[model samples]
Target: MNSLYHGSELCEVDADGNVAVPAFLEDAFAPETSPEIVVAKHQADDCLIGYGRAHLSTLAERAERRRVAEEERGEEARSHYRRMRGTFGLSERIKRDGRGLRIPPAMRHLGRIDDLALFVGAGDSFEIWNPQLALESDDEHFRALAEFRLRMRGTKTAGVH
Candidate 1:
């Protein structure tokens, strides 16, 4: 499974809505075997999700597995399966040119993306967010992050008596 992504990085969105992806993540898309990328709504968060061909396929497979298993269960499970299927279908593939990949309209609106966006690296997928929204979310997000760290820190004595 792809690890959950976190944090933010600044990136420019061009006139045509294309944005350059961070070079560090280029390899993740290689499995997709296409320069084209897909942008869609993130299920659990207020952000835009980006997927390469391979990653999308992996997501499809997982959804399919859930669907098949749900089929054996009943109506409720089936409904969930249908919803998952529907979500995958909403994905839009981005076209790459000399500049970068263009963000699709649906995703653009969903993320409120404009001239500038913040690309956040999540292990298996990345999220694109409008700069202002990102800034607002970061305050709350970072506070939670700090709390998490504090909980995880081991207590130690500063000095011996």
Candidate 2:
């Protein structure tokens, strides 16, 4: 079976730009191989999506099927190239070290991430969001979750005991 990701965790990002992969999501990584994750921009949102290295093959296969279908319809190659560029060209594969994955600068900019990253799992993949920005998300579920996280973070930071 494929690695499935679910649940959410808020992780800290260091000054050097490393965000620890939430322990809950560890199952996404293969035990035998070095930990590697692919980070890409969410197609319809201002957030980043992450998945195990193995998922890349799934993406390629899907893209190939789309290409063939488009070709059968006599569609121009532009559509395929556009899809490839968006899905492959803009993505980056980063390896996790002892501390965590060093988020690439380009991805950070694309994701608008800073000191805190909210990781929300979405079955096949997970999303990394800048909590503050996520509060304005068009997705009601995401917006509500982000608000709850921010409130929880505030409570913890200001806890008396």
Candidate 3:
């Protein structure tokens, strides 16, 4: 099972732009043979996004499936095919230098990354953000989260009394 990346960790982007992958989430990058990760721009927000090897594979598979389906459909499906294909791809491996992993330049600009960054663990993936932006986003995220929790308060789980 994959562990989710959550919570905030204070991390510094080194002089070479490398940052350490939090030990807690390292397990998600298992199957050590495949050390490469996929970093993309967050679709909904300004953040450097990280996806595990397995997750990236799954995404690629899905996109291929869409392409096949679209080919059988019509030109209308071309746009959908393009959208899916454009979304995800493999990223550079996290480099080691006795310091940390080096973030790629493309990801840096996409996430608006700076010297100070926040690594946020999301299920199956992680997000990197500028410290200030992360803080501001968290406020809005949590506010909406509270409302969502309130809406779910009465929901019952099979294991819960």
TM-score to native of every candidate shown: 0.67, 0.87, 0.66
List of clashing residue pairs for candidate 1:
5-122, 32-54
Q: Show where candidate 3 strays beyond 4 Å.
A: 1-3, 31-33, 64-75, 78-82, 89-99, 138-161
lDDT of 1 by residue, 1-161 (tens): 44344454556777667777655455445443566767888776677888665576687677778777877766367566556744676578776554367887777878788777667677777877665555445467743433333234431212211
Task: Report the number of the highest-lDDT candidate.
Answer: 2
Q: What do the candidate models score in CA lDDT, each in turn?
A: 0.63, 0.82, 0.62
Return the lDDT, model 3, position 120: 68
Say which candidate scores most in TM-score: 2
lDDT of 1 at 24: 48
Q: What tens digits encode model 2's per-residue C-alpha lDDT throughout 1-161?
A: 45788888888888777877787677566677557788998877889988887888898999999999999999999989987887888789999886478889999989989899999888988889988877777888877787778777873322223
Which segments of model 2 are wrong by more than 4 Å? 155-161
By lDDT, is 2 or 3 better?
A: 2
Model 2, poorest ten-residue lDDT window?
152-161
Runs off by more than 4 Å, candidate 1:
1-8, 68-82, 138-161
Q: What is the C-alpha RMSD of each candidate to the true structure, in Å?
A: 9.2, 3.9, 9.5
Total clashing pairs for each candidate: 2, 0, 3
lDDT (0-100) at residue 58 of candidate 2? 95
Per-residue error (Å), model 2, residue 48 = 1.1
Q: Over the full model, what C-alpha lDDT does candidate 2 score relative to the true structure?
A: 0.82
